[model samples]
Target: MQAFIGASLLSSSAAQPKRKPFEIYDRRLQGFTLRVQSTGVRSYYARFGRNRRVVLGKVGTLAPEEARERCQKVLGHFAHGRHPLHGIGGTDAITLGMFIADTYTTWVKASRPRTAANTLEKLHRLFRTWYPEPLTAITLERIESWKARRLNAGRSAATVLRDLFTLSSVLRRAVTVGELTENPVRRVDKPRIDRRGKVRFLDQAEESRLRDALKARDEEMQKLRTAANERRQKRHKELLPRLTHFGDHLTPALLLSMNTGLRRGEVLKLRWACVDFDRRLLTVEGRNAKNRQTRHVPLNEEAMSALQRWREQSGSRRRLFDVATGFRTAWEKLLKRATITRFRWHDLRHHFASRLVQHGVPLNTVRDLLGHSSVAMSLRYAHLAPDQRREAVAKLNEKPLLALTMRLQWDGFPAGSHYRIDSMVEREGLEPSTPAL
Candidate 1:
């Protein structure tokens, strides 16, 4: 029904529908509407183009005059061939903060739960100044200026690049939802990252020390558990279970990652259903994997033993390792005890790949075992396989061609005179050294 929407008209029950909601068009302004629901909820809407409707606000929150002003602004933007949400002066214009808080937050939480919090935190922290600014204002110049500031403030190029990628992802999502015409971050030149930087893996001595430390840690934890159980028994309380297997999940978890090269998240999220004892295989489920593709890793003797002991201790729990927060404290202590420096948990995976490559395993095979999508990622360990390259070159020494050439040299044939050698070979009824031209 057409009416001059105001406080008196909005408060009247005669304008409301009985069964379903209905829109009341403004008599003074064309395409301005007040939607009155059957539940007595009223909201202002502005219709533009053929049927595009933009909600201004609810009745009680936005007064009639204010909603009318907003509606006029939206209609004016449309009349000038501009999108109300994209127009700077329009009340419905979407800001960076609004888009992220209202739209991107919910999506990233559901789609990328593992890194959702980190991504959101980075967006809020890194782009805090841009929060109030419009998404269209995130231009190449502003980002380059931000990049320069970040670099000057001691942030690495890799760190700045990661921040840029996160921002670009948000902008790309905005473009996908028609909020923006394009992602301006795409036009910005990405920071050059060194792909072949030095990989930090454990050496033999460091690995041995780390193993010793882990053993010591297990013994210490077992001793503490036994002491606690003994005290419990003395107090006539229910006796805690004795420590039979390894102390805690730390040792087994570390060993499993070192052996299987599963990522930290993948290991923590691993379920018992994915581990096959009979087949000696560990499956990384697609949902838990970083690449979102399932891949099975064969468990070696050490890996199998670690899982077996851990399973006995873990009982019927679904997850193999139920560590939600990770073992950072325990890992740090273990590293300090071992006197290892400049190594991260992720380096364990690199160590696994390095050992395989050094032992003559093919790079493609290592790539598959590490669950990398491409062999290019495994190339960092290529330098470790100097023996393999040496052997490849050594194979040339065993070729019959080498022997034949040496024999010809011993028979007084001058080197680098292929024409003369070919004529001599033809005269002597031997096959020509070179093919006839």
Candidate 2:
């Protein structure tokens, strides 16, 4: 590297081998340096504001000539009497706190509660006492410095990703709303967090225990409903006991979810018209489902039986499962009383897949039943079948003769006939070479 007047000459094949906006701040580069990466990331100035050299944008869609033009325009604006970013917060003239707060207030209002709460949590956790003081100005380097701070803080990759996502949203929104000329958050690279938490699922024994517990609660509720009707307690202290009759209805809800593997939201929106008693099938329309793909799920006798019981109990020709019926909170209390503490209502759907994989179900069938957008998600239950680790291996073992003997399983598979091929090969006098070999 040679020092160019008020600058430095960095070889294309230098020790670092590549230049990013954050790296320029850590290294001793002279006045102005340019790093043009093959990935189309380009940044203009190396340094030269106040005792420290700083980098600008890593240009891509905007070419090098255009970047040079834009930088010159910025410099000329700074040189002239005009304050181009008069009210902006991150410039040499603006305090960092005002900038980020203003960024949050302006950009985050219309986001959903789930999204908004997440952003708020991440912002408070990651930036709380450590962000720039009110008087201190903000710089791009200060923002990118979060990469190191996040790692040292022992935050997992997901937490770091969430925090960075919040920052990216705020800054990107700033550019669109004309608060800032660009987004600095996008300029920085995202951190890699090793060892993400695996999505927990119910094993076969746990799934059965859960079902037995839920069934016991259901039976108790049914018995209570008959006993309570004779006494007639109004919607008061006795109101909850009457509501507890609704507990009988919970079995069908649980059964439907476990059988169909639909999201809780989709289940909450189910209607009588979607259920065909004669056919014993439930149809969820695309508009109601997350993937917007209509699914016709064949109901097991138990799932259908549960739905029938709900119809007899409610008597209203309205929605099958009313979210406002107060059973949402009721079921939580019921679980505590029942002492089934290992799962959420949503986990019932996961249990659906878990049970199927444990009993030799194909992953693609599980994916289709759950309405997953891809088999990659459904394949997570590979742990359920340690013998058949991946979908490819499982499919390689599958024979077309399965249609002849296997029936629909309770957990949602063509079950109990994993050895249909073995039977066929024995009768036909062919060796079962796949397993034998």
Candidate 3:
């Protein structure tokens, strides 16, 4: 309730309290005050913008001088039209863990569940060290050092970059909610990723091998399931059902991925409602799509036939495949059984795009089918378009000449060729500057 010239009087001033709570303003620093509670507790706060005030810290944790300095920062932010609690939060006590749990993850789960899950996993694994630290304690230098440590620890640039981006996004959200004045991640340079333009897709031989392998796998599964069912019924008389559910999913899932160019998440999350048998269209809803954009992809004969067979077998099942449990293990086994090497599930998308480009589908159409946000993403497949570069080169000479001037010299052509040359030159309205012999 009174002004003080120096911080030396703060302890004495806080030792005594009135019947109700009151604030003692700093004579040295405007907007800085120490709040004295009726219980004889005191804390520093910065008052700004009418009735708005943000806590700096308790008296014991921050000296009066330190509190005044922090208040000056709040005043500076308020001058720039930013909230005083931008970096410190409402109470200056919220930690990185609390901010992520209470705010960042909630928004991410609503807007992009896949990203939320992935980022949460990576952050927990890579950044648990910072969980207990206050949000304001994280700095640009610390982020750069963390990136360097990750790179030195044999983490890929792409993976580290993804983790860094997730951290950056969380901090940026903090900024939006006035929990951070600035994002430290923005000041640090992202790791340089060397992504060459290599489009990995199945060629004819690889495709044949893959199909044969899949057929073999299906047949092998059928044999095993039949044997299991026979033994369960006749020999064991067991109460449990057959274990054949696992094998049935892999073939159909791979088939759908290869034919439709669907990402793994999209394929796993596919439902019956999104597929229209009548229209031969598979619709990826905005919520389920990677870019949050809806896209309708046409089903070719192969995809259509596969879907029809799957629908009959699914028999009112909400999901087309029981792949919700996940396919990583089965996928690895299938690849190993088929002797396929160095191919991930995403390569199937590339296979689809490659086939389309080789068959002369336009890049923009591919972009739409793939649900890419921009044509630049689809441009990687432009090289695969059949005869595109060749056609461009062919345009160099609209009408190519085929005649040969054999036995000719600097002089005019021989008697019979003279008419041809003269008429051609006259027609073109050009000069014949052949030196006379």
Candidate 4:
């Protein structure tokens, strides 16, 4: 039979002695008791459901009365068919690696494949060390320290912020799925970027130099193609096709980028189906656009000509560019040949927007042409239209305002008359001008 136990017995060391682990019933509370081990260590627990047992806490840590109250709650949960630790993962087995690999990755890929790939790359690059750790181990202090280190290492605030955002998103998903109790990232602040960073775009001189370099490169590629054609044989024909003129693709790609303001990915992913040469319109489908909204860009004289020439020369029936690889190498070579410095491929898009704004294109029109999700994003180029600002200010110098000022100053009296007119004299309490007759 189990002996009834109470707070007095738990407080008095003499009431307990070294013995095998055994349970004593609490007279004050049914189904709640204190369990004593052979070495005299004691803990409280509640038993229910025939075989169900829940440990409340250690003897001193939780008094008998409090333990009994907790036991009552435990029994309540058991009666409702709920495990006390159900929401917390079983044995705390949810590690960051498991959550990211098995949960977040699968969900992200299904929802947004391109975003998933980019996010995975950033996660691996920035958080590989934390991948195998428990999700709970990613504390707010650790994240703040990591962010400080990243900033100290000369990483751009925007880049570091993006990485932090990605990590926070994964943890947020974990919280949603019950793999984590909370997202620590919610407690941390994000890095701020400098708002005044320069927007790089090619000026007229730089553009002319770049074009001259492209022309030279084009001539060289033509000569190489001619030589390769003359020396072609049956087995060598396979290699000869790969040696096509670089200018055939690169020049057209550069020209198209500068003319249409299409992003690099959008430019590369362009398909023949979206190009309506007859309508003179190029469509960036919603699926491929960054903002996930379809935008139609009308081809200009230069862009249309480049596309036509490329289609005729390369015979690339599917994608516009035949080059399968990336543009970093060719871009760097082109920059070097042109003797231009500190320019990236994305700057070509900036060049297009700047030219349009300078030529008096409305900002809303530029926003639509660039496929920006918001007008605020296109506002960066608004300052480029200084001529418009000057014209607006120049309107203040027009004759209408000057004429109104003159009328106010003379009060409808003739400038040549010494005396005021009848209307002006009555208003100003002065004598009316004598009639000339």
- Tens-digit lDDT string for candidate 3 (77-101): 7787554544543435767887787
Q: Which segments of candidate 2 are over 4 A away from where they belong?
A: 1-155, 178-199, 233-249, 273-296, 325-341, 389-437
**Better model by TM-score: candidate 1 vs candidate 2:** 1
Better of 1 and 4 by lDDT: 1
Query: Per-residue CA lDDT of candidate 2, range 338-418, in tens?
Result: 557766888778777787888898989888888888888776776677775475677866765555443323223334545
Identify the runs in model 1 with alpha carbons over 4 angstroms from their true place: 1-92, 391-437
Q: Where is model 3 poorest over a 10-residue stretch in terms of lDDT?
A: 399-408
Each prediction's whole-model lDDT (CA): 0.84, 0.61, 0.78, 0.78
lDDT of 4 by residue, 335-394 (tens): 999999999999999899999998999989999999987788888887888987899999
Separately for all candidates shown, the number of backbone clashes (residues 3 or more apart, or on different chains) is 0, 6, 1, 1
* lDDT measured at residue 279 in model 3 versus the true structure, 0 to 100: 90
Best candidate (score: lDDT) = 1
TM-score (C-alpha, index-matched) for candidate 4? 0.69
Look at candidate 4 and give me any clashing residue pairs: 19-38
Cα RMSD for candidates in order: 8.1, 17.9, 8.7, 11.1
Evaluated at residue 134, the lDDT of candidate 1 is 79
TM-score of predicted structure 2:
0.53
Cα lDDT tens digits, model 1, 1-437, are: 78999989976876765688888899999878999888978889989777778788988899999889888887886675444655434423688887887668878999898899999999988888888887778888998898888889999989999899999989988887667888888888888888767888998899999999999988998899999988988999997766677888899999999998989888989899999999999999989887889999999999999899888877879998888779899899899999998899999999999888889899999989888899998888899889867988997766455555665666655455453464567687864243223
TM-score of 1: 0.76
In angstroms, the error of model 2 at 277 is 4.6
